[model samples]
Target: MTSLWQHARRPATRDDDSWSVAGNVYYGTGRPIDGMERPFSPEFEAKVRHAYKSNGPVFALMTVRQMLFSEARFQFRQMRNGRPGELFGTADLALLETPWPGGTTGNLLSRMIQFADLEGSAYVTNYNPGRLKMLRPDWVTIITGSEEEPSLASEAIDSELLGYMYDPPTGSEPWFLLPEQVAHFAPIPDPEFQFRGMSWITPVIREIVGDTAATRHKLKFFENGATPQVVVSLDPSVTPEKVKKFQALMDSDHRGVDTAYKTLYLGGGADVTVVGKDLHQLDFKATQGAGETRLAAAAGVPSVVVGFSEGLAGSSLNAGNYSSSRRRLADGTMRPLWREAAGSLAQIVNVPAGADLWYDDRDIAWLREDQHDAAEIQGLQSRTIRTLVDAGYEPETVVAAVAAEDYSLLKHSGLYSVQLQKPGTGSGAPSPTPPTTDPEVP
Candidate 1:
């Protein structure tokens, strides 16, 4: 970008009053271009490539300082020379094109993106009075402030082209205190109001950024069970063949399904973890339903419980459980499992309602077979495991009984078709050979 100042480099012959900028602007101006306003060209890209290949690190340092100066309005301030916007320093610049090395275009577009973001926020921090009026007069924009923003319009947003929003001021300068302005901190405040203005208008600067990024190289996305892909241009209209190279760029990189699932459900916090246990050292006990309990257990150094939290943070996930896979929201239909379990003896089982005891088919049968006594059932229900005495059934048996289901047996056991005299062994029928494989075979 051309500065608001010009100095003669050589000795002036009376009327000649011009001077070249000295000392490398980092290594003397790396490449004198047509200027900053016009967009990139092949010639410009080539110049940038030469500058970087010859002196990238130096050019990068120079561009960084220039970007900061142009964004800071240091040169513009200096050129005013005690006129309207005068100041002094090596940081004198009003405007500047991004001067970093773009990978393909040889311009540093990624760096430009960072500079734009920083410049916008930095501009806001200074509380400049002239910035509101500095926008191109041709572009229509709206600014809002009750009394202070005299250069602004009345509405929070406007219809013509650009608009902005700010809080109703307690005082003129309090516009700086507005939370929306603070959180978003827009550059030149966005065009905003009439309710048509939304957060999306913030992308007006993206044309510069997008084109810059596209010219350099391609952006890529590697998704699990999907393509690792790249695109020449983010423009949706760009031909797909142009972006086909992304397929080759995407290597396995050791990313896995757990990473994908975490990206989906947890929305990408820290990456997923793995816990390996040596099976040879672990004892094998015939603990009934122990495998299923993993969903409820939340212990160990790395704890991961499924189907436990009722409403995880901000969303819903209680969608399934057990063989029956009871309706996700059974509470609507008196099927609060805790209540049903608690009231079975009295009428309103507490188990389904309060989540004390989950039902296992074998547990109910064992209770009925060995101890149909009311005291035993009620005692087990009311007392914690520690408070209750030995109930005759082993832990494994009780667990298996309570955790068991009859769904698999009901499916293929002909119970659905044959007229049943009684269910299970009570029918007094001879046992048939079980299927060699799964009863629910595909």
Candidate 2:
């Protein structure tokens, strides 16, 4: 097997401004110039990072990264007849466990999930032995091309994934890496682009903006003396200077939380009119909680899992509902992510023949509730194998058939068990007791 560093050493040659060799294909020759460098939008990535740090709901959703990083380990799994078989470890597994000098698999996974979630894609490259580097998603560009000169009309179908280009913002020359040397993980693909991925946050950007605005509004309410807007009306006879003086006094004495509930001494002919509603009157929790739920939905995590207000209220915290929510997140979201991560990282790992890199989630505490279901399924499969073996089927074929859930794979052994055979029909059986009865009659 070729090492990742060995593949990285063979950088694609750039022929000219218009054409370049990326992996096995000439990237710029037939591809559109505008589509040549496909980089994740930096502005969007920045916005996601900001929201993750500043917003409550987004931050809560990001906590899923910890669970993902902690729950699973990578190993080689044998594939037999389209079914996963035994899982085994090898020297290559060490690379994932200790990707760098001090990095563990969790560290690598956390970074992968963070970048993938925030930027819609993550790239992992191995330029040195026993060390892996994660590229900034927005800085790395995907390079695609065609094996043959594609026509303008057939480019979409003829185009193939070539590799990636890592162009840093420090004005250094870009590094070109073959596809096998870099693991490109984009769990969510962008519908607009052929190879680009789309961020889950993209769909709920409006919701995030609304939620942020609501938070700011709450802060401002407290800043303004924790009171609703008040319009001070002075009589027509009052002088402008007096009105200005009164406004200044109010701002100085009672305009902030520090001065909240202070006595207000209004001059004669002054009328105070309250405008707008307080936080309670606005039902702040319901408003912000709805947006939080929407954001969680987009994150593929149930609101209950994130401890959002909407999820915590009512019966969402009930044992059954909570378990279901956990199951949804584990099975529907994290499992798929782990699978994709394994497949992508397979590019850098040395996998044995008939074996694929897979995540071992059996030890994940988050999914321990699923153990009962797994055991039940195993019991059923064991019983099926036993029945099939006793019914004249080959033992090996019976096991394979039961495992694959395809009884057609079972082969007959042309023999039957004692229970399934006719009485006294075997070669070892006594000749029918008729001889003894005939001797007695004679």
Candidate 3:
């Protein structure tokens, strides 16, 4: 594998003289002047990774990403009459199931979603050996393009995508990929650009930074012993030099975790005065909890779901609100993401005309409540069909109309059952009135 720096020194197409800068200044090879990777560097990846490792909210965000990609299952359907016609399998099935030679569908999708959520967009190139299969996501720096044509006059279009420049991480010679050979997935797309998505992490970065700072503060506080105090004395006989020496001795003997609570030996009328406040006094618990809660909220996860102690013992634990929060997390946060990713995949996979890619959330245990609701609704629909059929309507028509929501199936044969009396006709008792008239006459 050739290094990115080496790849940049290779020949470039068009006016891509942007690599004239120092090799270290270039993020990766094959990038254009206006490419999104222009600002990216190895250092940026490290920074994001550090935040991921140190921040609580980033962990929650990643949890959401994993659940969305793994739990939501994608399927293909055929289109008919401007609607989804039927379920059918295509070459896309095999391709998606084994996106890479070694990867499963779930792994591929999960990786793509994670990268997109973190980096704003994910790019994958389709490699066909014998068939149109095999996919590999490229790092942002490894792929570059210029927006020669905007989809809208104001925004770039996919058709305008000239080509993809791929610089392998192994330091291989750089190569150019035609636009047709690659698939770009962007969830929150940039309105002004065609190739990039807006990162969800960008908005909550400050919250993440704050959480990291708080964690580090707590660690340092505990490492220096679980107490905060300042010792002062009113010993006029003691010189300032003696006080400085005493402070040094105190730090060495009692300030560390191992030396915490060790007895301090003082002499020459030196008095120890506790001046610093404890962690509780500084509202450490509140600040940390509040930061986690804010981060969870930004990630669309209720704090309780992410195991945050804040509000877990209070109203957030109530069954109703907790269930509602779970539902909101699934519907409001995750489902839309699933839909977006499925849509992007449809572009890569050969979806049958009229059929679109859809997700199967029915099997996900986290959303079993929705399945229960669906069962109850199904029961109601069955009752509707029975009632309609008993009302002299054709059973087939009733079922079809109810199932398809097509009122045209409600065209009923104007006929009554033997049990139901015919319209505009009297009851078949002939004349019970005749006997009463005879009695009146007598």
Candidate No. with top lDDT: 2
For each predicted model, how many residue pairs clash, with residues at least 3 apart or on different chains?
50, 0, 12
Alpha carbon deviation, residue 341, candidate 1 (Å): 71
Ranking of all predicted structures according to lDDT, beginning with the best and ending with the worst: 2, 3, 1
lDDT of 2: 0.76
Lowest lDDT sum, 10 consecutive residues, model 3, at 17-26
For candidate 1, which ten residues in a row score worst on lDDT? 1-10
Prediction 3 global C-alpha lDDT: 0.63
lDDT (Cα, tens digit) per residue for candidate 1, span 311-411: 23223333332211222222221123223221221111111221222222222221233344556865764453222113333334333233232112112
Error of 2 at 160 (Å): 2.0
Instruction: Give me the runs in candidate 1 sitting further than 4 Å from their true place.
Output: 1-201, 204-442
Best by TM-score: 2
Candidate 3 total steric clashes: 12
lDDT of candidate 3 over 365-392, digit per residue (tens) = 8888888789999999999987777676
- Between prediction 1 and prediction 3, the one with superior lDDT is 3
Looking at model 1, residue 425 earns an lDDT score of 49
